[model samples]
Target chain A: MADFFNIIFSVDFGYAVLRVTTPILFAAMGALISDKAGVINIALEGMMLISALTGVIMSALSHSAGLGLLGAVIVGALVGMVLAYFALNLKTDVILAAIAINLIAMGGTVFVLFMVGGDKGISSSLASKVLPRIDIPLIRSIPVLGPILSGHNILTYLAFLSVWVMYIFIYRTPLGLRIRAVGENADAADSVGISVRKIQYTALILSGALAGFGGAYMSMGYVSWFSKNMTAGRGFIALAAEAMGGATPHGAMFTSLLFGMFDALSNSLQTLRVPAEFIQMIPYLATVIGLVIYAANKTEQIKRIQAHQNREARKGAQEVKLL
Target chain B: MFKQKRLFELVRTVLAVLIALIVALVTILFASDEPGRALSLFLFGPLDSLRHFGNVLEMMIPLLFTGLAVSIMFSAAQFNLGAEGAFFLGGITATSVAINQSLLPVVHPVLSILAGGLTGALFCGIPALLKVKWNASELVSSLMFNYVALFLGLYLINYYMRDVDAGAMVSFKLADTSKLIRIIPKTRVHFGLILAALTVVAGYYFMYRTRWGYRIRLTGLNSSFARYSGIQTASVIILSQVLGGFIAGSGGAIEILGMYRRFSWQSLPGYGWDGIIVAILARNNPALIPVGAFFLAYLRIGADLMARSSDVQSEVVYIIQGVMIVLIAAESFLAHYRHKLVYREARKTAASGK
Candidate 1:
């Protein structure tokens, strides 16, 4: 237990946590944006999966990181186009469509991976470029905290900055209001100038962009190569994080970070003599518990406040009678 | 009324098969370097080989069982995804039972099969119990339980059932009496195929004609309405899942007994996911399960052959499946199939909610 406590601050462990958190944050925020617009985005996992493969394939061919990243975005957008076409133009079930996307993406990635590498599940032989790391100048000189704060992969900083950017976009922008309005009541938004389909499509495209970046970062920043279906279940975990965070930017970030921490701990927990399967079960189990608590608390808290209000009103009534 | 419904069913089945065919043809063109003969070989190729035909049946039996499993449960509106885990564990349990109780009795295989069915049902029942008691979402809990089932199965196989003489993560060899007898020459088709078909028939009877099935279907159509009618919705949901688990568990048991000398499946077998597709294609109709299973079985067997022949990965079926599932979910095709029972009922299902 003492050794376990000491290792929590270790650099490798911290980095693992960051790595785990980064992919989920990217996907969750993407989900958050779409969901805020009232368009259910279950396709985030599918988006990550296909984009990851697209990033790998492009990087392999072009040997350029920018091209790979761009390639991933395009791939994401194409997938987004299909989703938008169905959810918007076709009037399909959004959740069902998302489930379909996830299924296809899962199968499609493995297929493509095997096609290129002639391997069953992964590709290691076709070496690809990863995202370049950035060195922030003065931040490295501060103290023990400096090492923790500075010298993260460029995507890490971008992931953190996305929260603030999204928060501003959600609260300060006219577009954000339109989206929220659309989410709140589609018919009302439609009665106004806002197009429900347009908002859903826009949110989906933006979602694809963020999820694509998540895919690129996983391949380039976290690891050197793409394995068959290597996104594991992080995309689903990201969705869970979004639900736990109550679909807010700050709430999502907090839960996303927590999920990432658990994910990292699971992988590293084996070193601490925990069973590998239990470690693997952590983040997923966390999702189930987190959702139950978050959902249950909403009802419980509302009841408490209502009870208090009733008590206050009764006291006022009694005072009036006495007077 | 019955004639119209039958015609609608016929049309839907044709459309589903045609969609799958088109996808297969497109895949073949992209896959083959020598497209002329290879394309023909991909489509008509499975029929030429007795071996491939046999392989198709072997594949069909497990999927048929799983498809029936899913269709039955989905009829009750309980989307228990735990069948995959149950099937895996059930296979292991059957293997373990067969290996240990070799000298017990003449009815050793029957007992082992029963053990498999019971364990699988119990594995699925845990999630159903949670859903009934805590108002927990079965989808989430069952998915979680899948992992538990997976790990536990691995543990059991590794620690107890493992055949030391075998190469990798597999189970011990079973007694000679436990090995299932093949029904067809040169095919792995055992009595399990008949068992699968019987289950589908039983499933159809349960879903369409029986009192308990009426309760399950009514509860599925609308829980509030079912409850108003004095149905025990919670128990029906749990019961359907248990039954579904039993069928899938027996499928796994048969898969172990008939297909190999020892238990060899090390990881997830993917029958459950395919079963999901089969259920959707059948539109959750129990009667269509056999057709759905056979269609899936053909695709899998044909793809396996294509991969082996051309060295192209069969994983490409996923892209095709993704496209297909995406299209299916879109359901704009319903406009064309407006005459169908399911499409009309689904429209009413949507309308009633609104």
Candidate 2:
């Protein structure tokens, strides 16, 4: 218990949490946008993976990190478009289509890697450019906050900034209103002359772009090289985070942080007597527990609503009889 | 009418496969310096020798089990995908049981296999129970459970069953009595193949020819209707998933017993995901699972051989697999052809005016 508290309260642990939260934060934001637009983008994993590959290869070829980031975002949007085309136009099952996309990305990356004379395991041969880390000039002067807030990869700041951006976009914009309306009631949105499909497509594209950044960060910012299956189910964890956050962007942001904390804890726990596997299991296990708790609360709320309605109905009947 | 429908289904499958093959061929043409040789090797490499043929059959063993597992649960409309974890835990659990030195010879393998199956059933049951009780999403929960099972299995092997001197994460070797016998003269194909075949047949009979299966099918078709008719839909869903888990679990046990000298897998063998593809290819039919499994194994072995003999990597098959699964699963893919056929049938029936 002492060790746990000591680790949690440390500045290093705080930094690690922010570092670990980067990819999941981006992916969760993406998931939040797509889901709010009535499109469950389960292909975030595939989108992130393919973007990671594209980011590395493009960066290596162009010798420009910006171009590499652009390439990944483009690929992500294209994949999202493919998903929309198949699911909406072609009438494919969304889940199945997403699964197929994930499988393709998984294999396609290795195939492309082999084609480019790169090993299947890692992209070590390529001297790919990495995203720059930013140290805040003003924050560096702070006594305790400096260590926790400064010297993170540039993407980490963007990931945190995205939360605010997403907040503004979702809550303070007409387009966000349309997206949420479409999710809540597509027919109603359609009735109001909002093109439901068009909004969904836009949402999916933006979602893909966000996930693309996440993927790019994994390869270029989070690490210097692209490794096979490097995203390692972070995309799914992001989905869980989004769900646990009650589908609100701010909620999703906090959930992502919570998961990131668990993830960092798992890494730190590796030095302790605790089994690493068990420690690694914490985030995923938390996802399940979080989901169950969410479900139980929803059920309780529904029961309360039903009881209130029933009591109102009984009172109305008694009033009628007295009259 | 039924025959016509079946024919259309067949055509659709053929078209999907053809498209997948063309995609694979295009990939090969771009990836390989010698596309012709690579293509030829991919097509005929698996049939070049008896041993190669045995490799296909050996690959089919686990696919058969996992395929049937997915098919059974899918037919019950439960998307519980814990088979991956179930298979992993099952392998380790069976290994733990097989490591025991006191069990009778005949009962040893049986006990181990049963233990593995039960462990898998229990592991998979968590998601089902959660879904039924709390209305939680089965897909997400099952995915989480798979990771948990993976970590738990690894922990068991690392702490309780590790053979440290072996210099890897492998467990202790099984006693000779627990090791499965090779039934073929020169191949590693064991009696497990026969058991796999028998299980497929039994699964078909159980699912298609039994009353319990009727309830499951009805539940899948419309749970509300099944409930209206007094079916215990929850139990049906849970039971089918449990049974599916058992099949997949035992398959894992069979795989380790038949092939390896010790428990060797450190990560998922991917048989469970392959089973999903198999289930899709078979259209979630128990009777067709073997054919689907065989076709998948043949493709895999062919790709493996091509990778060994040519410049093309075997991962190219995954592109084909992805295309095939998406196209086949897409309800609107080739919808016009089916629509035309159904329209013709409707016209014929109207003209008969019976």
Best by TM-score: 2
Q: What is the lDDT of residue A81 in candidate 1?
A: 74
Q: For each candidate, what is the lDDT?
A: 0.78, 0.90
The fnat scores of all predictions, in order, read 0.47, 0.72
CAPRI verdict (incorrect, acceptable, medium, high) for model 2: medium
Tens digit per residue, CA lDDT, model 1, B1-354: 467666765665566557856876776677668655655555655687787788778888888878878877777888788788878877888888888744555476777778888888998887788677655557666766776677677777777777787888777778878877889988678878887888888888988899998988898889999999899898999899999899888888888877878788756787877787778777777788877777777777667677777755666666555555556555565546554566678788799999
The C-alpha RMSD in Å for every predicted model, in order, reads 4.6, 1.5
Number of clashing residue pairs in every model?
Answer: 0, 0
Flag clash pairs in model 1. none
Encode model 2's per-residue lDDT on B1-354: one tens digit a residue.
Answer: 999989988889989999999999988998889999999889998898889889999999999999999899888888888888889888999999998888888799989899999998888788888888888888788878888888888999999999889998898989788877888777788878999999999999998999888888889889999999999999998998889899999999989888988898877888888899999999989999999999999999999999998998899988999999888888899899889999999999999996
* TM-score of each prediction: 0.89, 0.97
